[model samples]
Target: MKKLMISVVAAALVLTMAGCGSKDSGGTKVKFATDAAYAPMEYMDKDKVAGFDIDFLAEVMKEAGLAYSVTNTGWDTMLTSVQQGKEYQAGISSVSITDERKQTYDYTAPYFESTNMILVKEGSPIKSALDLKDKKVAVQISTTADTLMTKIMGGDNKSLKRMDNNTLALMELESNGVDAVVADIAIIREYVKNNPNKKFVSIADAKNFESEYYGILLPKGSDLKAKLDPAIKKVIENGKYATVYKKWFGQEPDTKKLLDQK
Candidate 1:
């Protein structure tokens, strides 16, 4: 359900920001902005940006015959900068495609399937989305998880704590400040795998949490969409995508189903 987004109308951004892209033998590299906070998708590995989305983007750009670079500029900066289409040409922070966001930007064909999942301390009574109705919950602000939880908890419910990032949201749950944290499955699964001693459990409620797809965020009418789509289709079909998927997830991706999605 989420990893990226910030509610900003992103008017013309300042073009003064330094540290942009460099040229390559092919041409100037496509500049990408990402919030290096979403793991198994995109996150900081020390000083370097590393994860599934980063590795996947390498394949995508290779297929498209382009050079590219990604920067860890945080979610809000990434969203607004990419929206302006000045500082960065595209964004790939596990950003989910939704109707509300479609009004602001165009997106490449979906590359990943995801859904919100609940991360609760082991032995918690919560089992589904409905179970959190009266419970304290934390979610990253302005994400699909935030949007959906707002509806479930009622618009102004104080029980829903919206944090600046999922790392903070999960921390709140770990500290018992909240009963659960709602975030994308990739994030939840990665956290659980790395923190086995945390004694956390993940629950997938298929009824309340529906399928969502992640796409490369682009500014409206951007030319990259034309170049990226075919490359995405080719990589997904020709087995390149599955290799990247299995590298991060340790399992084969459902390319058949992924291709069938709009």
Candidate 2:
């Protein structure tokens, strides 16, 4: 009888562990990879991650009845992780859903929109990407801005240097080591906020290549979209998304207008 009771207890423990680790029939635990260093979009505040993207995901997951977690694996790695399906189920690093990315991974409807801009030190001569010619410019490795820089400078501009993080690129601009840095406008705002003494300037919207925004990345042929699609639709309808948006971005997001046209 003693041996039988021990056997039953062991089975019960194994079942419990499996239950804890497995996703429910209608729910899934999404591992979201992002660059935790980008502020206002995604960043670490003390021990917790808090930013526009983080807060937006938390709300969307709750509405979808999905379990998810965010892992900081840098921007470049975040892209490859979802592609390889090594550690994450999706990515939320303000990744612009381009045709190239869509060829491999599915993207959800866009949750935000932005345009790239040039950030120069206060009172610098650098005014635009053209002005960056023959000048030292820092760009985050593998970002849209970095790609655009390559296109403008023949993909081998001697002055264009890649950095691991956008913040570091901005720092180079602050220290006067680089003439300018290229990144999204929203990210530039956050950088300037953190650097009080450094005044960053952006030229009026110049006609250049721009990137559209989208969320949701799944491994090729993954079935997670059924769950994410409904949650995104419901969140937009019930206004929970807007509430969360206001909390992070200080204004309501216009997701409905953009997604409606789709």
Candidate 3:
């Protein structure tokens, strides 16, 4: 999720890797695709891609000494493009590393931790995931939130409303089309912070939503993992990772927990 999504329509962009602005040793520049709808993770800041993931990717690419560029693409496009390894070599829009995805893509070491959160208008009776089992809930399609809610509400649950991205899911809640919107905690929190007038509340249900890790995604069998893992580890050990985390999250990350998952 670029912020859980981590798009419905994404305009493509080609940008130089953050920092040093140098090319990889092989000089073969790579492309990283992402859905830039999830705010605070990746989003369109006017025309440029801005957010934590954009900043983190700059650090990872610089550490790996790889030449790369990130583009704004829809969620499905990011998944399919990275899988082909032709137009896009990798992706990093807050993508969760799951057993099913590992079969289709190679993931760099776990970099961040997240879980689905329930979002509702203030004063709503919905307090947790269970409360939404029979209530109309909105979620972005193909995201971990969607998958988790499906398991809890059943795949055929009519109350489960799936949107193309978190933005629309939140909109559904704004218009009272759904009882709640489920998505990554970061996306839920950021939206609430940005829309104080909306009076939204985010609920964390540890009992139903398990913690998950985020990783840089690559095509199955892609060799990029070999270069990225060490670079990602170095950033965490040296405190750069925490610096970026603090900048965006306003608090120190559980670096120890993140490293242990690697």
- Each candidate structure's TM-score, on Cα atoms with residue i matched to residue i, is 0.91, 0.80, 0.90
What are the runs in model 1 whose C-alpha is more than 4 Å off? 3-26
Q: Order the numbered candidates by TM-score, best leading.
A: 1, 3, 2
Query: What does candidate 3's lDDT look like per residue over 149-250, in tens digits?
Result: 888899998889988778899889999999999989999889888899988888999999999999999998999999989999999889999999999999
For each candidate in the order shown, give its overall lDDT on alpha carbons. Answer: 0.85, 0.68, 0.83
Of candidate 2, the 10-residue stretch with the lowest lDDT total is 1-10
In candidate 2, list every pair of residues with a backbone clash.
Answer: none
Error at 245, model 3, angstroms: 0.8
Model 3 TM-score relative to the real fold: 0.90
In model 3, the Cα lDDT at residue 66 comes to 84
> Candidate 1 lDDT (Cα, whole model)?
0.85
lDDT of 3: 0.83
Tens-digit per-residue lDDT, 1-262, candidate 2: 0000001111111000001122343555577777666678777777566687777776677766666777776555666677778677887777776767778788776677777788887778776677777788888777777887888876877789888677688888878888888887778766666677756776544577454675766778766777777777777778877887777667767775657634
